[model samples]
Structure formats: C-alpha cells, structure tokens
Target chain A: MKPPVISAFEPPRRILMGPGPSDVYPQVLSAQAKPTVGHLDPLFIGMMDELKQLLQYAFQTRNEMTLAVSAPGSAGMETCFVNLLQPGDTVVVCRNGVFGERMRQNVERCGGQAVLVDNAWGEPVDPQKVEETLKTNPQARFLAFVHAETSTGALSDAATLCALARKYGCLSIVDAVTSLGGVELKVDEWGIDAIYSGSQKCLSCVPGLSPVSFSPAAVERIKQRTRPVQSWFLDQSLVMAYWGGGAKRSYHHTAPVNALYALHESLRVLAQEGLEQSWQRHQEMHQLLKQGLQALGLQFVVAEPYRLPQLNSIYIPSGVDDATVRQQLLRQYNLEIGAGLGDLAGKAWRIGLMGYGARRENIALCIKALEEVLA
Target chain B: MKPPVISAFEPPRRILMGPGPSDVYPQVLSAQAKPTVGHLDPLFIGMMDELKQLLQYAFQTRNEMTLAVSAPGSAGMETCFVNLLQPGDTVVVCRNGVFGERMRQNVERCGGQAVLVDNAWGEPVDPQKVEETLKTNPQARFLAFVHAETSTGALSDAATLCALARKYGCLSIVDAVTSLGGVELKVDEWGIDAIYSGSQKCLSCVPGLSPVSFSPAAVERIKQRTRPVQSWFLDQSLVMAYWGGGAKRSYHHTAPVNALYALHESLRVLAQEGLEQSWQRHQEMHQLLKQGLQALGLQFVVAEPYRLPQLNSIYIPSGVDDATVRQQLLRQYNLEIGAGLGDLAGKAWRIGLMGYGARRENIALCIKALEEVLA
Candidate 1:
C-alpha cells in the first residue's frame, strides 16, 4: 500500500468556549513553538524550576511536591489515586458529575473499594451525605471529589469537604481540573491533600500537561504505601526524582519540554494577573454570559451559588437541536461550545468563560453567535 | 509569599544530537506555534484523520488501531501492556537494556508474570534465547522486546522476535521508540502484534505524544479481556473511541493539540522524504560520524551489525570526564548529545543522527565539537 499524501495541517482559527482548551493565549502558543531543547539540558532544567514555582502560585499552595504531570488531567487524577490508595483500601468518592464518576473509576481500578456519595447531576456534592458516608466507612483511607465538575458546571465546596475528610482522619484527593485558576481554591489553606488541574482549562495553555500538587500529608501516605503505584507513568514517587528540587534530576519519563515552556508562560500570565484577579475575571465574564444567555430564555443546569463560573451549563432551548446549533455556531461564527456529556447529554450546552476566553468580546460573540444560530 | 516575576524564557539555540529529541525541523516547530484549536473541533478531528494515515505510512501498517497516544512513549508502553495482558498471564520479556527493564515493570504492574530472557547491554536480543524462553513458558501470552534499545544503541531483530512470538502462539509487543523513522520497520509485514514509538526520537516532533498501532490480533485480545483495563487514561478501548474513525469523536481526554500539529508536520516531512530515504540518511550520517569518532580514538559499545545507526553508543575514553566533556560541548559549541543510561551510564555517550538531525552538517559539527571538547 502506498503512503497517503498529507499536506501540512493548517487548523482553522477558532474561538474556543468549550469546557477545555479554552483559547490558549498567543504568548503561550508562541512559547510552545520555542526551539526544542533536551529535557535534561541545564537551561531546560532551570526553566522547569521556575515552572514549578509558577505552578505553585497557580495552585495557591506552598507544597514542596508541586509539579506538572507530563500527561493530561485524567492521568493527574490517576496519579493522586494510584499513589495514595493501595489494594483493598476504601475511599469515599463524591459523585456529582462526570469527573467525580471518573474518580470512582480510578479508585476501583486501583483495587480500592469506592463507597460512593451520590449527588444530583449539576449539583454540588452534598456535604452532609459525604459526612455520613465517611462516618459509616470509618476506615476509609481517602475522600475523593471534584472541586469543580466540568461536565455539569457545578462547583463543590472543597473547603468543607477537605475539612470533613480531615476530621474523619482520611486524606483528601481533589480534582481541580476546572477550578485551578478560575475559582477560589487554596490548596494549602483548604487543606487539600492531593490536587490535580488541567493546563488547558483555566490556565489558558495548550491541552496536554496537568499541574498537580500533593500536600505533605499526601506525600507521607504515598511514602508509606506497601505496594508500588500501579501506573508507572503516573507514579508521583518516581516522577518526583525528575521534578523534585535540587540542581541534579533523575531520568524518569522524558519530561514534555516544549509543553512545559507553554505551561510556564501560562502560569506566568496567571501570576501576573494574580490568582484572585483571574478568578474575578472568570466570574465577571460568567455574569455577562449569564445575562445574555438568560435573555435567550436559557436556564442554568446548576443553581447559581453552586455553579462554576468557568464552565456554565445551560439548558438547550426548546426548539433548538444541540448538535445543529453547535455546528452552525462553529461553521458560521467559528465559535465552539461544549455539548453536554453523560446524563446531561443533548439536554444542555456548556458555554465556558475560562482564562483567556473570559473576555467581554468573547462573551458578546458567543451570545450573538448562539442567537444567530438559534434564529 | 509573593510569586516570583519570571521573564519570558529564551532557550539558547543548540544543535540536538541526543539519543532522542533530535533536532526538530523548523517547519515542525512553526506548525506547533499555530493557533490552538479545540481537541474535538471538526477541523482538528479532520487533521487527526490525516495524522492516523500518516502514522500508518510511518509504521508501514494498515491496522485500524493506529493512533497517536496523548502521553509519551512510556505511557504508550503501559497502554499495550495493561490492555492486552490480564492478571496472572505470563509474558516473555527480553531484557537487554533500560527500556526492556521498563517493559518488565509494565508487565509486573499489569499483574502479569514476566519471564525474563536476558542479553547483555549493547547487544541485540538473541532470537534463539527468546524461543527457548517461550518454549519453557508455554503459557506466556506475550513476547515483549525493544526494537532499538536507546540506552545502549543496540538494534534488535524485531522481525525474528515477532516470528518467534507467533511460532509460540503469543502476541508480540514491540518497543520502536528509537527505531521508527530511523530504521526499517514493516509493522504489517513483520506481523507485530502491538508497537509504540515516541514522537521525540526519530519523528523529530515534540516529546509528549506516543504514536502506537495495535494489530487485529492485539485488538481482539483487548476486546476479549475479562477484567477492565487497570488504567482509565491509558486504556486503548476508551482512547480508541476518541481517535477512531468517523467524523464524530468521543471526549476521552484533551489531546496535546499543538504537539499533534508538530507530529503531523514531522510525519508529513517524513513521508515527503520517504522512510527508506530517512533510514539511508541515518546510516550515511552514522558512517560519517563513525569515521570522525574513530579518528578521535572513540570506540562503539555495540558491534557492527546490531548497532543502531541513529543512536551511536560510544565508550567514554579513559581519562575523559563524561559530564565535563558533555558540559563543555554544550557550553562552548551549543551542541547536545546524550549520556549513557542504566548499565552503560558514565561509560558511554549516545550520539544521535535521528530524523531531521541526520544531516552531513550535523555529523560534521558533532564530530568537530566532540574533538574540541575532548582536547
């Protein structure tokens, strides 16, 4: 068979308002294009150090175990779960949306028993139910939950959940994939034992790397684990030897060099704006989108207080077809919005107001695009 | 503590002649700088189709399971192991160098017993030894080996190994991390059951993505597995839904969009040059490097036939400090070469002439740089 002749791939410029990969900053993209360097190059290692410090700022943590996982957010979630939970361990998993259910899968695949604390789709994980589950499963080693559920645009109270886990003498694993820069998450202050976030979502970076931080408590648990971490790629212990402090670093898996360059630029942008200010921008843009969406008679899936400002889930209008409207918007306006996933599929559309995508112009363009498509 | 203000990172221009991540083409780097798009965007998905076809050309395979994994090659290795091998299954793993040991780790982590068939570092796996091991462990479900061991620059007989696996009624999992684009590998003709390669090595793309292909037999094994794949992220079944055929793609994980762009361009460059030409160029450059290194009193670690032309592992001369020589090369000549890994560490240097890096000029420059540094 002859090889297919493929021309240079030139992707169309898009206005990404989807759940993730939300319009990476031009600087970040440019940074990504920087000349490739050896992963262990002195220059690259220096940049890695700065990248870690920048990640620390974005995660709002002073944890020494902070670094970007070489893979995506799903791998980051697995890293936390595989490192902390051993076989036959019991973990109280709060399932409110797609990511929470994914956490349960991680738990079960790691040979841990998942005692699910269920909540309505598009609702914050019920703190009361979590407490009860933890009380009943008193031997639970970990309490896992998604801080901001991207699928349903619901923001759970991570602070309260972490407190509950601490009170119950269990470590907490938090999925901050959608919450890192777009919401108020203080990994140190909120006492999150292990947290993972996507670089694409609210970090306005390319979609590959996952920034993760493990609190000292989480690190201690990993250290004490009797068995080796299941996934070698996601194993935090081995990875730390590469991303850990000090000038000399060990060879684990090859670090994603160019991607880290993009991440560093994104985190630097976040630091410049300040995490609190970035959060405010997301919230402000969400309000603008909310007013515009409300005018179109769209009802939000999650209640106002529990809603994630970065990911806004709204009901599909009565006569509008979900795919048709989204397709039309993409074709005509080059604007992309996420279709609902899992149980909310075809019933909702996710309009994102994430970092770099959270501009007034984007909000106006998305609303106008939807209006035109609907008409 | 306030976040440290970091300036834009400016990496020095260095001629990459390392074991992997050899000099990325200027066009590939430029492609990576293109505007970021949604991973599931129609345009991006269209690009993804072309990428799969391009990968098929590179791998010389028509297998429908060909796709670029979102993570690096290590994860790709894990993907093949976790998907095909169930608990208690025995795998005949050929341990010749660093990556072979990694394969054993993957097998053990997947709850499979790894029956080792050992060979010396810097030497290809002995096909007779592999056959003996397989005959002994008749229950072994798979035969795993690295086609090109990056640690010692030894090229194994993948065709012979695959044949041995087939003769024993076992699947073959081949690591082509350092072989793809640098050597002749006919995945279809050789009947490789599963294979994984890195973008960074001979593809001359960025380091993150892993291009993998599974034969129908391997896919069947994955489909027939009784237990769920241990990893949710690396599970090929879930990942296939996103990278598989058709216009519609399920959301598995956010792909490294920019990295894929780089891979597409690199593959396109490869196709234009043709695989045979790429391999010839590597061999030609290796010959040039060989003459130059011999003049400088350097000796190769591997014997003539088994040595990988792309990755030349040369013994460190007596009285020469390995790190000091490499550091001088980088500091003075702005050239990068790889230090030996695992058993070969401190005793050898891996000089690469991979995909875009395989040039007469690169060969000349690297040789000249090394000579000056040694002096």
Candidate 2:
C-alpha cells in the first residue's frame, strides 16, 4: 500500500481568553520547539531541579515534593486523591461546580467515601458548611475543594477552608487550576496539603502539564498507605523516585520532554512578572471587563465577593440566542468565549481573563466584539 | 520574599534512544509551538476530526471512538478499564513487566476483580498460561495485556491473546504503548475491543496525550453500563459528547490544543513512512543492534523469538556497574539508554530503537558507546 500523504496543518490564529488554554507567550512557544532531550539526561536533571525551584516559588511553598505532573489538571486531581486516600477512607469534599463533582468521582473510585458538602453553582464553597461536614465526618482523611472554580467563575476561600481542615485534623487538597498565578495562593501559609494547578490557565503555557505540590503530611499519608497506589502512573511514591531530587533519576514512563520545556519557560515568565503583579493584572482586567459587561446591561453570574477575576461568568442577555452569539463571536470576530456548562448552559457565558488572555487589549477587544454580536 | 529570577532557557541537544521519548522530529516540535486555539473552535473541531481519522489509520481500526485522551498514557489506561468494566466485573490481566502491573492496578482500582497471570520480568506472556487462567476464571469479562513491554523489552502475542478473548466470548484491552507506530498493531484484524498507546513512545510526539480507540463492542458496553463512569474526565460517554462525530462539538475540559497539533503532525509522519515500512525499519535496526551486541558479548535478556525489536533488553556484563555505565553513556556520548526496571534492574540494559531512533546511525553509535563504556 502507498503511504498516506499528510495535508498541511495551519491553525487559525485567534486571541484566547476562554476558561482555559489562555494564550501562549512567544518565548514559551520557542522553548516548546527546543530540541528533545532524554528525560534522565544530566542537563535534563538540572532543568528538573530548576523547574522544581520555580514551581516552589509559584506555589509559595517549601514543599520538597513539587513538580509538574505528566498530564493535565484532571490527572493532577487524580494524583492527589489516589495518593492520599486509601480504600474505605472518608473524605469531606465541597462541590459547587464541575471540578468539585470531579473530586467526588476521584474519591469514590479510590474506594473512599465522599461526604459531599453541596452549594449552588457559581457560589463559593461555604467554609462554615465545610466545617460542619468535617464535624459530621469526624474520621475524614482530607477536605478537597477548588480554590477557583473554572466552570462557574467562583473563587472559594482557600485559607479559611485550609484552616477548617486543620482544625478537624484533616489534610487539605486544593485545586488551584485557575487561581495559581491569577490569585494569591500561599500553600505554606494557607496550610494546604496538596495543590494542583494547570499551566495553561495563567502560566501562559500550552495545556499538557499540571504543576503540583504535596505538603509533608500528604507525603506521609502516601508513604503510610497500606495498599500500593492503585494507579502506578499517578502513584506519588514511585513517581518521586523519578521526579524527586537526584541526579540518578529512575525510569518512569518517558517524561513529556517538550511540554516540560514549554512549562519551564512559562514559569520563567511568571517569575519575571512576579506572582503578585500577575494576580493584580488579572484583577485589573476583570474590572475592565466587568465595567464593559455592565455597560452592555449584562449581570454577573457569581456574586461580587465570590467572583473569580480570571474567569468572568455572566448571564446571556435576554432576547439573544446563546449558541448563535458565541458562534458569531467566533466566526466573524475570531473571538472565543466559553458557554455555560450543566445547569448554567444556555443561560450564561464564561469570558475568561486569564494568563496571556488577561490583558488590557484583550479585555477591550472581547467587550467590543461581544457588543457587536449582541447588537 | 524575592521571587526567583527568570533566566533564559536554551535546550541542549542529545540523542534519546531510551525506552521512549525518542528524538522528536523538528516538524513535530514546531507543531507543538503553534498558536493556541479554543478546544471547541470550528477550525479546531475540524482539526480534531482530521486527527481522529489519522488515528484510525494508524491503529488500523475502523472504530469510530478513536481519539486522543486529554491526559497521558496512564489516564488512557484508566479510560479503557473504566469504560469497559463496571464494578465487580471479573478481568483476567497478564503481568510480565511494569506496564502489565499497571493494568492490574487499573483493573482493581475500577472495582473490577483482577485475576492476574504472572510471568517473569523480561519474558513474554505465555498464551498457554493465559488460556489456563481464563479456563480457571470462566467468569472473566475481558483479557488485558501489554503488546510491547517497555520495561523488559518483551513482545507478547497480541493476536493470539485477542483471538483467545474472541474464542472465550470476552473483550480484550491491549496496551500498545511502545508498539503502535514502531511495530505491527492491527486492532481490527486482531479483534481488540479497546487499546491505548502513548504519544511519546514510537509516535515521537511530546508526551501528555494518549491515543485510544474502542471497537463497537466496547462502545456498546460503555453505553449499556448500569452505573455512570466514576471518572468524569475519562468517561467515554461524556468525552464522546466532545470528541465524537458531529459538526457541532460539545465542551468537556479544554483540549490540549497545541499538543494535539503535535500529535497530528507525528501521525502524519508515521503515515508517510507507511506502517509496514516503519515496522521493517525497526526490525532492520534491531538486527544491526543485535549483531553489534553479540560482538560485544552482551546476551539477550528476552528470548529471540519473543523479543521486541524496538526495545532491546540485554544482560549487563558482570563487573560493570549499571548506573555508572548509563551515566557515562549520557555524559560522554550524549546518548541515553534505559537501565532495567522492576525485577530486572541492575541486571540488564534496554536500548530502544523506536520511530526516529530506528536509524542505522543511532544503532551504531549506541553500540560503539556501549563498547567504550565496557572497556
């Protein structure tokens, strides 16, 4: 048989300000295109060390077990749950949106019980309710919640929740997927045990890596687990042998070399901007977007106190078709805004100001394009 | 506290011929650096359609469920098990190397009962033993095994195992992580119900993606399940809403847009090479490496009849320290080869000749480096 011919792949260029996959910085793109190196090469180890250091700075934790997980944010979530909770362990998980529901699933699959603390979509996980749940489930091993709920543009109070977990003698597993660079997340000060964040959200890297940190208590649980971790790939114990501090890196599955290169460069950019500056930039852009949306007579889906600056969720104006407006925005304006998911679908739109997307120019352009579409 | 300073990153060149993450093609590298786009953009949807078609060709399967899982190969494994087996389903899993052990873990984690068929490390799974286990565990719903054991460089008879599954009226889940683009993998012809392979292996794309395909039977099982998939991210039913057939795409999590671009380009490269031609090249390179290793007095760890041509596992010479030799190979020649894993660690070395690494030059260089290290 003759070989199949490959057609040219030319991706249409567009400004990304969606819930995730925020734009890529030029230098990060270049870094992604760098020559491939063996995962265990000496210089690659040096690069790993540098990556770990940068992640520490970004996460604001001295947790020695910090590194990029080989997969996406979902995989990072799975890693935390699988490594920490053994079969039959009870966990207090707060659910306000999509990610919280995912945590419940991870808990169940790990053979652990999820004592779900429910809240309305687009609302923050109430720390009072979380505390009540922990009291109810006195033997719970951990409390898992999303600091920034990407599906609904709601930001939970991470420090308060971590404190609640601490009071109950439970570990805290925080999902910082959309909050890492866009908000203040101090893993050490907040007493977060395990936190996982996505690179594409505000780090401006391509979406393949998830930077994660595990506090000593979480690592202790992994080490003390009775059964071996169910998933070998996500097992923290074995993965640490390969990704942990050392020149003699053991073989895990081949590390995603080029993707890590992109992440390394992305973290470099965050370091240059400084986390506080990046967080402030996201907030500033959100303000600009909020003003524009209010001018157009749109209301925010999340309350002001709980709204995430990086992810702006708003109600679709009356008399406008949801799908049609988003489609037109993409086709004519070359702009992408996320549609609401689950209960909010068809009623709201999620306009993201995150990472490279959280820029003054992008906010103005999105507002202009949205206004034109709505008109 | 002062944030870490951002330093310019420049990747050094090296030859990666270890178990996986072989030298990436320049085009694939550049593809990863392409501009980001929304996961649900019309153009990206079109590209995703093309990617599914390309994956179908690569896997030699007509399964419409062919697509890349958003996470890495481990997540891909989870997707297969979670979709096919409901809780308490009996599964017969064969374990000869590390990946096989991983499959067993996935089976157990998914609430499936795992009836393990154990084989020694660096040995191919014996079909007779698998048949015997199936006879003993007559209630087994599926048979799972690795096609190319990355850890031990052993090649099992996927065709025979799949045929056995058919004969016994059971489904088959095959792990073709190191075999897909480097060896013969006929999913349709072999009657494989579900299969998952890694991008960083023979495909030579950046990691963080797992290309997976499911036959009609597997899809039916997924649809008929009494319980919802425990993993929302990996639930094929929900994922299908996003990656399945239709002009209208649904939203799941954000797609790793640039990573898909790289994967599509790598598949195109594989198609251009022609599957048969690529398989032949792997064989030829293996022949060269075998001759050189024999000359260097290195004996094969796996039997000749069952050895994987792409992953060459050979016993380390007595008195030569495994770590020192591997380090020297990396430091002096800038060549990377894998040390043995699992039970074979410190006893053997695995020299991979996969995809771009399956060249005469790389084989000769690896041999020369080995000879020098031994001297």
Judged by DockQ, which candidate is best?
1
Model 1 lDDT per residue over B95-207, tens place: 99999999999999988899999999989999999998999898998999999999999999999999999999999999999999999999999999999999998889989
* CA lDDT of each prediction against the hidden true structure: 0.91, 0.87
How far residue A291's Cα lies from its native spot in candidate 2, in Å, is 3.1
B70, model 1: CA deviation in Å? 0.6
Per-model TM-score (chain A alone): 0.99, 0.98
Candidate 1: give the clashing pairs. none
Q: Pick the candidate with the highest TM-score.
A: 1
Model 1: how far residue A100 lies from native, Å: 0.9
What CAPRI grade goes to candidate 2?
A: medium
Pairs of residues clashing in candidate 2: none
lDDT of 1 at B248: 72
For residue B344, model 1's alpha carbon misses the true position, in angstroms, by 1.3
